[model samples]
Target: MRALDLTLVLTNMPTTTTLRLSFSPSPPRPLSNRACPHGPVISQLDFFAFLNRHGSFLTPLSCCSLEVDRRRRSPITMLSYDSTSNVLANQFQVRELNDETDFETILSADGRFSVCGFGSLLSERSARSTFPDLVNFRFARLNGFRRVFAHVTPVFLERGIARPETKEISGLSVEPCEGESLTVTVFEIEKSEIPAYFEREIEYRFLAVLPQTLDGKPFDNPAVLCACYSDEEFLRVRCKGSKEMFFQLYGQYNIDKIWQDDILPCRAYLRHCVLAAKKLGDEVYDNFLDHTFLGDRKTTIRQHLATKGSGIMEEEPPESLKIRYGG
Candidate 1:
């Protein structure tokens, strides 16, 4: 294991002063008895450059240190490491460091961290369209949550809704089930990408969730259930129409209106989602249907297609809008 140590000291003086940095190999002895191979002192610019070059060797929380003097409002920095000579040979084991508990603990401490994706994000084309920075994704399941079609978008009549609700309301929101889990494609993203990720889910709220991998182990990252509906909305929709009536109304809406305005209808968008799930194999497709709401009811993909008819499939999306499902 390669390690880095840096120390920054600031003075209490009000006027500007030079910041001092000390870098040394780990002790058998302290810096007083040793000579820094890089040199005794380095400029702030050089220090940043060195960090850029060797940052991967440092642990997640060990790369930098900042201390502020409340009295003077001054800052202090620190860095320390043994030697860079054997760094490559003793390179850090990233995977080992990413153990489930530790990874979850680190992210949970930040409070504002989460990784969650369903609906169009489950499809490669839609995901890529929305999150260009997303690179790796895994099939995971969120327990105690379900999918619904409650979010009303201008283009698509409805969007997937995930929230805690009772079975008596709309069947779209995930009800409090004892053992059921909602299937989702969880993306592994850098901490910096979080803001942009939530940007696409503006209507949703992040509910902390710990998703499990297909093999049943906890995924080694933070996740959230992105809920697009609330308790009030669920009850309101329930009073408005039955599931069959909702679909009937949806079917009568002009699909071309969406296409002419360069948008996708709810059913057409759903076709892409179904195709993506089918590509993931039977288990995923079935889980998707069992969890998601079609109008006011929960129906299988076949039933949805048969009832909605080919009109929902009328608008063939351009290749760019189509998703190539699976890895």
Candidate 2:
């Protein structure tokens, strides 16, 4: 039998306990331990909550094997055990953490932080490049938002894909809409790996959202977060249109001074996002087409797909782009 060692600290109290469990492929036996007289009851109660959530492997034990470490401590960092992976297979439930959730608590809780992707990140390859250690790369739906290719960004220009002449200089962003939901990919990454992530997702402000699983279940954690929408200030400036908003949001990036309505999506980037969705399966592809829209928010991707414009999203990147940008 292999022993699983778990050390926990209860934020609601001031105590620490180290627990050890011996595991096998059989039913669990009733195990018991006495809480140290000095330890608070919270130290014992939260222990049960943790175990209860880890599959149906353990019953509501009245007591737990606890070794008191009386010295004050920070939240214990999570240690992964092989036996726990199976329990994590379906972690779509409500999170106990809040918006101002403690970093140490979040980082140590199995290192499970979610990132929502409704655009190019629908591609596993694209997402993995940013979050190499990501796990549970799965699909979910974000309610109360809709996708639109209206965020004017410098990334397209940096990659040499912008068409300022045709106003195809926009990336993707989401806007709040009552009773609307967008299909998106949700994946887990360690909190420690996100410094570079902020750089890649510089245009949008990341916020915590509870995306619904395919089966309509809530995720166990709400820290599944990423930048998908503009902040209030950006929205206020965006009223002047995509071009004006871009200038206000990023001053130095506008070296070319070529700003426009951003009525169309960046050709190369849009095509990449569309093809990535297609590869996820029919549902995702259909969702991308039916739910996505241009800056006007009136023309759907599907409607555009029915026109000659479809060729832009289906054909290869331009010859000039090939020298600068790969698929």
Candidate 3:
């Protein structure tokens, strides 16, 4: 599969005019409804009609299937069907293409570094706080690694301190898994932000990775990978949490008092990661849920909710855990 950066162009036109969009480094091919094999062929008139009706609700950089070189690939593009001339005008004003050329300059320029984030950093809100001048971000996959909860953190260790009898909990890490691939968000930010990012990730160590987009396009620049708790470290530190604790906290769907106190922050972080995945859309989100692990197993939010019920019905975080984690 090939990656294409697309641009939408609208010429002086009337309300009934056809919408036209262009792709850089490639020309537009005949648009087809590849989504449905036996469905009616989508004509320009049908496309325009649908756009005029639902255009306002559509996100500017939404993903859509396009036939390219005899294969279907999803390219980042803006397409709108507007009933009014100003609708197109308004949409274009709000969204502009951040082209690959600009991205390359930002990547090659000084005071910039590429980091692969697989956790809370995947969230736009979290990443934006650190890198206000974030150049770009995209979905990428790291092969030969699997995410796990193998690193003992200060917060969990603090919990252990408070209740010396309670088993210690650990945070997330990536371990080598031959033939496995871990989905990550590869983004570029100013070098000035590196120190703060590292501070937040005190347990992780940086490793170099040649990042590849989901479509197998290798990034030109090497990405900084933050990893923790290799097999050796896992064995030496015995960072694994009590299997009993894992089942009690995450195995069921309900939020027990212990879960609210000890597991809520981590669950909150996981929610952020899920939100980021959702922003990428369903296919990407499904892939993320499939590959990611909570403690020891891959579980979906639906499964969690079915088991635990909603937060509204759950009890508050226990005072002890709140004070311990400084929540």
Per-model TM-score on C-alpha atoms: 0.47, 0.58, 0.46
What's model 1's TM-score?
0.47
Per-residue lDDT for 1-327 in model 2, tens only?
444544443232233323444333233332212111111234433544443543222321223333433322111222222242322233222222212243234442676567788887888888886677889888997765667776567867766778767777877766544345678998888776655565456445444556668876656665444333433323343334565645554655653332222368888887878888888889889888888877666788888667736678556776865522232
Which window of ten consecutive residues has the lowest lDDT sum in model 1?
30-39
**Model 1 residue 321 distance off true place after TM-score fit, in angstroms:** 3.8
Q: Comparing 2 and 3 by lDDT, which wins?
A: 2
For residues 1-327, write the lDDT of model 3, one tens digit per residue.
Answer: 355555555456563334333324333455444321112355433443444443233343332333344432233222334545455322221111122232233344565778777765666656666677786877787765556543444454334332213322435555444345777887887766655665555345444555567876556666666554233222222224444544333334221212111232244334445566667678757755666544433443445444542451233334653322221
Predicted model with the maximum lDDT? 2
Weakest 10 consecutive residues, lDDT, candidate 2? 31-40
Best by TM-score: 2
Clashing residue pairs for model 2: 93-218, 93-219, 93-220, 114-224, 114-225
Better of 2 and 3 by TM-score: 2
- In candidate 3 the C-alpha lDDT for residue 117 amounts to 76
